[model samples]
Target chain A: MNLKFKHKEVRVFAPASVANVSCGFDVMGFAMGTPGDEIVVRRSDKNTVTIKSITGDEGVLPHDARKNTASVAVQKFLEHVGFESGVEIEVHKQMPLGSGLGSSAASSAGAVLAINRLLGEPFSRKELLPFAAEGERVACGTAHYDNVGPSLLGGFVFIRSTEPLDIFGLPFPESLHGVVVHPHIEIKTEDTRKILRNDIQLGQAVKQWGNVGGLVAGLINKDIDLISRSMEDVVIEPIRSVLIPGYDSVKESALAEGAIGAGIAGSGPSIFALTPGEESARRVCRAMKSRLDDIGLPSDEYISQINTKGAQVIDVKD
Target chain B: MNLKFKHKEVRVFAPASVANVSCGFDVMGFAMGTPGDEIVVRRSDKNTVTIKSITGDEGVLPHDARKNTASVAVQKFLEHVGFESGVEIEVHKQMPLGSGLGSSAASSAGAVLAINRLLGEPFSRKELLPFAAEGERVACGTAHYDNVGPSLLGGFVFIRSTEPLDIFGLPFPESLHGVVVHPHIEIKTEDTRKILRNDIQLGQAVKQWGNVGGLVAGLINKDIDLISRSMEDVVIEPIRSVLIPGYDSVKESALAEGAIGAGIAGSGPSIFALTPGEESARRVCRAMKSRLDDIGLPSDEYISQINTKGAQVIDVKD
Candidate 1:
């Protein structure tokens, strides 16, 4: 491939994401502003991808380029663009792993985005979703986009289908704030997924889809009340919440602190609440954290508006 | 309670509705423009409700005020307002019964709307949904608002819940046209519902809600391609289509005729297709009817844009 390199090295930051978003399990998600993964990509003389270093994950993440999410995503991008030269990837994990805040997705998104910048931007950010999702497939068994979609593209993303790759960016209230509290506990996505029932009642499914419709409509119309009312999970949360300690109390505290709605973030060990403004988001975060404190569980809390600019190039070296 | 009547009599027309709308089973529906039911209501000195007459039903409809959907809705509305004087209702069923075109919902919506007009409009159109839904409960043994919601409010409606009565008006493309073809057959709602499996696979539910979110976003953004792509029913249609003869062929014909999407209207012997404009709608209507015609099955077809004005007073007498 005759692709010219725009930069010798590039750095990118991909935001963390809250997937499922209560009623919209496996379909809807939004990017957060902080606690995201960073990827550093450098043009290499070798013809193969390699992961040079990792940080913030306590040496838990894989270093092999083929096995690691970041390198896998970079490798996939290079293959797609038919780049003869390879790239070296460095992953800086700024968030908790297995916390349900889309850790793997962030790494993948950051890697691809960073490399895309280095390669003179062969594809738009939207076009890079599949490569990021491929990394998700390596990390988890399924190549779901609910995480990578929002992480890469920013804002609220509604993934219609993964096979045909039908994804949509939904409009949300400008004042909308999200409070995410990740308790210092590990709950693997694969494990939480295993605990879910294979079959759910038709009535429950009906209620779920109704809320899904309501949530989408609420987000589009920026109806906070409607969004609050629709942010309920009758199917997955009921089963998954059991895995998180003090989940019920933490969620109640968020709501009591004037949050519009609260639910298990991704596969749990983290609880997220959405409020109308930053003040309410802060209040919700404090309340949720206090509940965890009372239960003697340490946690990390984040407050963010919707990250409208998803993965971006932070710095580049020629 | 004393209430001055603005009119001695009032007549209302409530349009028929298509419920489910593919991926949004039991939660979404839209109002049609024609082939609706007409309700004439007259104030009476008697303290009890009465069904004065019924037409176009071939005597299949009930005359008993307590049993009939129209009278039952009127009775509920009267009791709510503490009205001592009763009202006599006359139902003119312009649409076919047992055809999955929201037959009972139209009668109920028209009755409540007509009576409310005669009583000086005590309830706003939005406030009259429960009364119409009560009539639905009496008719179907369950108070589902998907049909009555659109039939009463007009436009596309996303029903979040029937219990707390959370219904939101959704914005849709004005150029959108619907083609409904009612195959002259009876498939009872109760019977078709019985055939549905109580439990659905979790994966299927995920895909269904994904599409639900997609459809709502599509409607809000007025993206025709997204709307068409999202109009899929993975759970309900596969089971219900068995009862409708030549359902596959009919749907294929509609799609081949340039319909954006097509699905069983409500519980179905009626199938509805949505097209981008009047031209494609007419083509789809002919195509669907031809499929039914090929099987020697007689059908009635109606082409309509969305009925933005749902139930409205057509006439008044002092």
Candidate 2:
């Protein structure tokens, strides 16, 4: 019997994500366009995981199959579905780490989505989340789904359960716009985790839940007034904001420029602004970049709509 | 010319509530039927707050208008809305205090609803919530809206935010049955507050959020499987459950008897069990009660459906 295969190679686009979207702390996340990573995966006859190419990195990322985010994610997916096949994965790390652009998550999500399609889509998007998170472990020393879920699924995501595995892709409120400022600085997830307190006050915890609940309700009901009122961090943002230069000034300036709310982007040296419209988003970007520039730092900014499409097989080449 | 003036008295009923439902901690709360407080407000010429009668308090409650739960709430409402005339409030406190039944909240809610009607409905239900919470402060010393919102609005309530006042009443899943076994012991809110540690581990906090998210999604989607799976508490229930007699044993017995979940009610002394049907709710209630009895603490129990109606004006005289 002769079997002919078509559309054998897949090119995946995974959007950059903003993890810990202010009020949600560890559970809320969303994806953005412009600054994301791309992964290209192909069916191969190799006996082991192989990374065929590397691009967009400053020659710092590893080419080893086990070390690459896409390759490890594919390996994890193979183990997940009990599949015994080898494939070649390529990484294009467009978004820089420590820029708070979800660099590792984008690559991890893109590779998994690409390879899963190549493998005939045996696993659902949610089933592939843990694999993406596992790949994230290689980059951050911890498996966090905040960025990975949004990167893979796109839009606004609420990670409802991690064990026994449940996640919710909530509806993105229409007319939502954002500005993300990436200051050229380096801060590893490990160092960021270390600086956070191991314990938090019960009072602060109550406030955190209040904000999370408000944020969820705001998104669900499309109540922009409530969303702006709820985007607050009395717990971690106050502590983590110090890591980024001009963080407070940038946030204040962003809000002053018609942005409704501003917060640290993930565990960052980067920050994000939520605005009501495209005009406000553009103004926020200008304000955030100017704040960073005033502090003698080179900053890259993206004014974007909330990316509703997570990870997808944009093209296929046999 | 002869001018005749007539006065019409208004009465309102507010059901007793249960807050911090199992794993929800500060976000989830719901109201109950049958054993709730009733307030009858009569329009009077004098500018004074007065509590005329009280029942079900075993003569232990205060008679002074300032000290009465319903009276104080009416006073706050009148002052806030600038009502110049006096109103006579009669409080029938049917639910017992310190039973985790939200006894004080019911009276507060009943008064606010009754007064709103007596004054020709000057404010929205959401506007009256803080007034109810203010009355709750007379009993609990703090303005935690968990109980007040549910008592005022009914159904399954999620207090999304309290700052700019965001409260959402989520749809109660069909076939949801609840069982309550009150141990007849007093567990004050202050005691519950005092026992909890000021600082909690970040890991535990994350788990708490996961459970909350799961519960919210379950409510939104009406997924019983998700609801049962999400009924867990690593924070408040664990520490406070120690204060309730046979708490662990009762919970185990209830779950074993087809209960979806069971936990210490409010802070302690009362235990609640959730089931999918009336039969299962009855069986779980019996099983939980028997378990408590075996531990030498027999309790009063109720098996009912989730209360969908909140506070409303009533005609007690009729």
Candidate 3:
């Protein structure tokens, strides 16, 4: 019997998400556009997986399907739900690596979402979250859902739990607009985690929790003033801000330009300003660019609204 | 100078409040009725500070003006606003001391509120919060606003900051019902604070903030089910519950009997149950009492609603 060669391919794009959102620390995240990655997967009748090619990585990313985030996620998905076949994965990385803008998560989320559709959509969107998070663990050493949850599910998300025993996803209000800026630099997530203190003063802990609560309420109620007031960090941001250039000036300038608030995005190199409208977001972008110029650093800005649509199959070809 | 009392003496009773409200830990609180202290202050030109009597204390309380909560609160109020004349303060200690019902805060809040009225209401209600907190420090060794904020201002309160700069007095929904039970034993607030770990895990911290945010929403929306579900703890209650007799049993029984949620009140010795209606509150009281009985402990239960009217001038007798 001769094996028939038929090619069925699908490609999906997942947007970059700004995790932490300043005071939210771990619970809140928002999706962004313009800077995202495209993942393409082709189904084959072989029991083995292969990485056909990779672009825009500049020789840094692995070509092995099992090693790359996009591949690892597909592998995990196939293993969990019992897949009798394998596929070839290709990643077209548009977002910068280690930019703190969910670059790796975009690929992973895109891959899982695209491949799941090719597999006839066996699982729900939430069921794909842990798999994509597992992909993030390949690069960051720990599975942090802050980035993956938003990238996979889209819009603003509150991760109630991640311990495998019990996980909760709360509703995020629709009125929030996330303004993200990616400074052309790299700050690894590991370094960001290392900068944080193992122990904090009791007084600082109370303030941290207070801001977290305030930020959550601000998001839920869509209160711009409360969100601005709540976008403060007395713990991690204070410590992590030292690594990023023009951190204080950019954030202050953004706020002065009518942006509700701005803070170090994720672990650094990327900064996000939250504003109420496109006009304020544009002013915030100009202010941010000026601050970066003053500090001898340049940045790319995106005045994008919060992306409510997370991951989906953009195209399928037979 | 001849001492003459021109104005009528007013006695105000403010109910105790449960601070930390499970997962809130220090940011959220709500007022409760029954088993609360009463403060009576008289306008006098004698400039005399006095504590008339003390009761419901098992030798744990002092009757001296300097040591009593009511006297200390009135004295602090006078010094803060620079009252030209002093006032006489009397305490009717109806609530049990060291029962975690915020007994100290009730006396302090009631005294400050009554004295403020006696002085022609010179300062606003919010201005009396710090003065009352000072009195609580005299009894608890540390100045905490959780109990004092709610007791003085009433309803649900979120203590955003606690220092020379404090933020509180947010609007709370009027639909909350707070059911409490005080077992006839003593659990010192100082001991409770001492037993808590100074540092908490980051995972637990996230959950704590999520619940706190949920609680604020619960209060704002007047959603009883949300309030009940948000009543959870990852830091304080687990450690404190072991000290209270039948704490787990009572909590389980209360929830089993239609109560939304139950947890250690303030710092234990008193446990509170939150329910939607009078019927559920009564059921919770019975459940809590039966748990106390099973554990061979004598308990006093109070089925009460959230006290929207905090500390007020009940009567003015010349």
* TM-score of chain A, cand. 1: 0.98
Q: Rank the candidates by DockQ, best first.
A: 1, 2, 3
How many angstroms is residue A51 displaced in model 3 relative to the true structure, after the best TM-score fit? 3.9
Would you list the rank order by TM-score, best first?
1, 2, 3
lDDT of 3 by residue, B203-282 (tens): 67767776776666665656666667678897788898988877888889989998877888888778888887788788
**Candidate closest to the true structure, highest TM-score:** 1
lDDT of 2 at A232: 89
Each prediction's whole-model lDDT (CA): 0.91, 0.81, 0.78
Score candidate 3 by DockQ. Answer: 0.44
lDDT by residue (A217-300, candidate 2, tens digit) is: 677767787688778888889888888878889999998998878898888878998888899899889988998888899988
Looking at candidate 1 chain A, the ten consecutive residues that score lowest on lDDT are: A78-87
Q: Which stretch of 10 consecutive residues in model 3 chain B shows the poorest summed lDDT? A: B1-10
TM-score of each: 0.99, 0.94, 0.87
What proportion of the real contacts between chains A and B does each prediction keep?
0.99, 0.54, 0.42
lDDT of 1 at A193: 84
Expressed as tens digits, the lDDT of each residue in A1-318 for candidate 3 is 112223389889889888888877766677786678889889876876778889988889998776899889888888887775879888998877888888888888998897787777777888888889889889788788888888888877766546641233344545556777777877878878887777666657778778877776666666667677878888778899888888888888888888888898888788888888777778888888888888678777777778878866778888
Candidate 2 positional error at B221, Å:
2.9
Q: What is the interface RMSD of each candidate, in Å?
A: 0.6, 1.7, 2.1
